[model samples]
Target: MTSLKLIFSLFIISFYSCSYVYAADLKKLAIEEFKKANYPKAIEILEHALIENNDDLELYYCLGYFTHYLCYDSVPLTGFDIRKSDEVLAYLGKAVELKPSYGDAYYFIGAEYGVRARRHLGKGEVDRAVFEFRLAREKGGLPDWLIEYGRNNLKTCDRDAILFTGGDADTNPIEYLQLVENYRRDVTVIPIALLNRPWFVQMIKYGIENAINAAPISWSREQIHDMHPYKWKTNLILIAVPETIKAELQIDKDFEWELEPDFEGRLSAGAAVLADIVKTNQWARSIYFSVACHPGMYHGLGDFFQSCGTTYRLIPTQTKDTELELDIKCIEDVFMDGDNYKSIASVADNNMPRASHMLNNYRAALFRLLIHYYKDKNKRRAKEVLDFMESTIREEYVASGALGEHLASYRKLLE
Candidate 1:
């Protein structure tokens, strides 16, 4: 009896060990496919892994994430059309079921609604979109990449300003501030991609109970350019413009229109609305734009907007002669390396998007900011910032492969 029991115990151990190794191998491959933007292949790998073990928590989360990415990126699945968003929701729902306490799961679910809202804006689905984002607020509060992105982007703005933006990457954290942490309670987050859609404009008006002037809800895309409608007492914040839209914008209207050709992507109705806001605002409330906003949105006013950390504070063109205050506060917040991203890199899956973003956007941005300060002749502050960066770049970032070895080389030059 003892010998038989021993054999059974060994068999069980061997089986689970093999199972774990297989799952690990599969996850690694799936992550690679995801990075390549080969969503179909990535999904196939995860689905096979699921067949091997349905209860794998990380597998479910990753499957949901990749599947959502496919639809979000407008890559239609062979049979499951991108319009069939519920399929994407189910995978995410499973992730939530497996780990209810995880705030990231909730954030992804809310993002699906944001995605769905953008698609169904014409169908008058704004209420449902608002509801899901609000639900995300209830569930999301963890300090992850998206939350940090939102916080860093908004830190430059005045308290209680309505900050307009778009994308799960950008807007989710802003919503996190309002709904979860209750930190920036009054700032209204408007996703500008949705603003490109006429129905969404009307929906925002109804859902937020804000009176948007000259919204042009009834106008067609082509007709939108003719009206000058955006007139609100509150300041206008230009959040984001899609690259495709940006490419279409006309950078400038030369005084000699006969000699100069008109550029293609001049805001049309969207740009017209911004022009009205520009005219009406008179800098009443502080007009700010996140640095992430496309340059096309500047419409010849690029010279007036100066980078202050993750955002641009609008300085009047007349002030080109006057010196502007250095935003020490923004630099301090963005570049501060109180604790490194060691814990995040150690635990994050091989292909986790947040880990890469942390390295690329936050860490790289800090490195550049260090150079900027030094070049601007603020040596003391530059050294102070460098010290904070040095603390993290070696062990937390360099020892681990989260950052390239080149960054270490860059540090040597900076010193």
Candidate 2:
């Protein structure tokens, strides 16, 4: 009996060991397919692996991740389709069940919820959207600093302004602030990435006309859908390019350029829609771009960009110098309040690359403010800016990099 028991235990141990090894090998193969952007195949391999090694935590997580991309890719208009969310969530939920402390799993789960919330919002399901936003806040584990970042960005704009935001980090938090907290419902938040889709643009037009009663976008749905980039020949101007934009671009009778498809030869639906807004609205309402936006999103209007705290307001007045035109009063109004600077600087250190990028943006802005004060010969304000930088930002962020060198050089200048 003892011999039989020993043999059976050995057999059980060997089976599990072989299973683990097989699962690991399958994981490797799946990852390779994922790297090649063959998301469906990657998901297939993982799904099969999970049958043999049901408890593999990474396997479940990867399955969730890959399914998310596949769902996003398969969607035609916008990538916020919630139909496959259940399957993705199930895999992530299992991963979390396997390891309750799995932070990445929790983050992805929250992200999925957030995306679903956006989809609901797009579909005009406000109640469902709010519920999903709440779920995202509860499950996403977004830091307080991010919420504050969103608040600060909103503060940068005037009441009833249109704010164009970019990417998940900048856009999601602002949406949360508006939909969930009811903080800045007056300001219309438009995601540039989604503006390419007719449905999203129509939703924005409806919301602007009905909810906010802002200046109506003149383009019909069909017009917006039909819009594409075209070359700028004087006789063949498809749409009337704003004189301000024309002057900014130095377009004369002899000048020729293209709008719509950017220099990369990729048509930018967002740019097309934005141009229409600018033309139709004629600055009836304020338009600001979050500083988090890529420069390309400015759509050749960089010359008119005036830095106002956390965003750049597009003014008609052209700037001659390429240097950033700072709204000094606005910057002081936003950042100089008691504890606000500290709060801005107090973003918790994390390994998240996005969070780190945001931190760098904040730091760079602060540095620009410091330089502005220094150039103005306002020693008191300059010293205050320097003190804020030293006191608030983590040392690790500035300990030994190019930022550190810049800070060291500035400190010597201040001394």
Give the per-residue lDDT of model 2 (tens digit) for 304-328: 6888867888766554443447777
Task: Estimate candidate 1's alpha-carbon lDDT, on a 0 to 1 scale.
Answer: 0.55
User: On a 0 to 1 TM-score scale, where does candidate 2 land against the true structure?
Assistant: 0.80
Q: What are the clashing pairs of model 1?
A: 224-269, 248-265, 249-265, 249-266, 250-265, 250-266
- Candidate 2, residue 300: CA error in Å? 2.4
Candidate 1 has a TM-score of: 0.55
lDDT of 1 at 23: 81
- Per-residue alpha-carbon lDDT of candidate 1 for residues 1-415, written as tens digits (9 for 90 to 100): 9999999999999988888788888989999999989988998998888877788888877877787777646344332355545776677778877876554555566676656544443355445544555555454423354455566666667764545553565766565555445556545456654454455555544334221212213344454433433433322334333344334332222111011111352334455444444444444445566555556655555565545655666544322323343355665665474542434343243223432343444555565566667767876776766676666543443333545464566456656
**Candidate 1 regions with alpha-carbon error over 4 angstroms:** 1-84, 93-110, 115-145, 203-268, 293-302, 318-326, 337-351, 354-359, 376-380, 392-410, 413-415
Tell me, by TM-score, which candidate is best. Answer: 2
Q: Candidate 1, after superposition: displacement of residue 260 in Å? A: 11
Of candidate 1, the 10-residue stretch with the lowest lDDT total is: 253-262
Candidate 1's displacement at residue 96, Å, is 8.6
